[model samples]
Target: MELKVLYFGMIAEVTGCNEEIILLEPNSNVDQLENLLKDKYQNLQHLSFKVAIDKEISANDTLLNPNNEIALLPPFSGG
Candidate 1:
């Protein structure tokens, strides 16, 4: 399955980009994707973030589909 991912705040800095299209295995969930991304970019493991499924932040291993729009977000900040 293929999914569109957006990175926000520090996540975008770590990844060096804002958006990406990922090809994932069928039935892959947040945890699996997290691990996969961590493996691909070891620096990502050092930062804390949440996985948003279609704009909703989730901590559970929610199932993802090709059409799903996902995002990696760091804690928001305001001055």
Candidate 2:
């Protein structure tokens, strides 16, 4: 399965791109994708971020699918 992943703020800096497509095995979950990213992009392993699925914040156990849109967002600050 392939999912579209969006990167924001510092996460984008670490990834060196605003978005990309990640291919995963069938039935993969958020945790698996996170681990794969950490290995693929070493900088991500040391950065702090949140995962969102189809525009909703999700947990590590959240199941993933080819149709779901994923995003990695850095901490936000605003008044």
Candidate 3:
């Protein structure tokens, strides 16, 4: 299964992009997927963010379906 991930704000800086597509196995959990990405991009460690599966925030154990639109939303600050 493949899902499109979107990076926002500072998250994009670490990843060097606004979005990318990630492919996962049928039984892959969100945590496993995050680990893969962290391993691939060393800079990701310095950032804080949340993952949303199909516009809904998902936990580390959330299972992703094929073509699900996953988003990596970084923290925002405005005052």
Candidate 4:
């Protein structure tokens, strides 16, 4: 399956793009995707970020769908 991944903040800096397409197994989960990304972008392994699917924060084990919107978001703080 091909998934479109959006990158934000420092994550975008690490990826060198705001978004990109990633190919994964049909039944791949967030954890698998994370591993693939970390392998592709070594800097990501040293960063702390959250994976959001379709605008919602997803768990590591969450199943990913073909049409789901995936995003890598860096940590943030607000007053």
Candidate 5:
């Protein structure tokens, strides 16, 4: 399955791009994707971020599909 992934803030800096297309195995979950990304981007392993599925923040390992829009959002800061 192919999905669109958006990177934000520090995550984007680590990834060196704001968004990209990722191909994953069928029935892949958020945890699996996270691990895959961590493997691809070694810098990501030390950073903390939240995974958003289709614009909503997801806390669990949600199943992903080809049409799913995923976002890697870094910690927020308020002035």
Candidate 6:
């Protein structure tokens, strides 16, 4: 399945782009996506971030769909 991945804050800086299309196998989960991303962008392995699926914070084992809105978000502090 083809997924659109969005990079935010420090994650975007590391990726050097705000968003991109990723192709994954059927029934792929968040962990699998993270592995693929870490392989493609070695620098990402050193960063701490959260994965959001369809605007909700998702767990590592969360299943991904082609139509889901996926985002990589760096840690943020609120005032």
Query: What is the lDDT of every predicted structure here?
Result: 0.88, 0.92, 0.83, 0.96, 0.92, 0.97
TM-scores of all models? 0.89, 0.93, 0.85, 0.97, 0.92, 0.97
Model 1 misplacement above 4 A:
77-79
Model 6: CA > 4 A from native: none
Which candidate order results from sorting by lDDT in descending order?
Answer: 6, 4, 5, 2, 1, 3
On residues 33-63, what C-alpha lDDT tens digit does candidate 2 reach at each position? 9999999999898888899999998999999
Pairwise lDDT winner, candidates 3 and 6: 6
Residue-level lDDT of model 3, residues 1-79, one tens digit each, is 7777888888888888998888777888889888888888888877788888888889999887776788888876699
lDDT by residue (27-69, candidate 4, tens digit) is 9999999999999999999999999999999999999988999
* Worst lDDT 10-window in candidate 6: 48-57
What local lDDT score does residue 42 receive in model 2, on the 0 to 100 scale? 98
Which stretches of model 3 miss by more than 4 angstroms? 77-79
The backbone clash count of each candidate, in order, is 0, 0, 0, 0, 0, 0
Model 3 lDDT-worst window of ten = 67-76
Residue-by-residue lDDT tens digits, candidate 5, 1-79 = 8889999999999999999999899999999999999999999999999999989998657999888889999998799
Model 5 clash pairs are none
Order the numbered candidates by TM-score, best leading.
4, 6, 2, 5, 1, 3
The TM-score between candidate 6 and the true structure equals 0.97
Better of 2 and 5 by TM-score: 2
TM-score of 2: 0.93
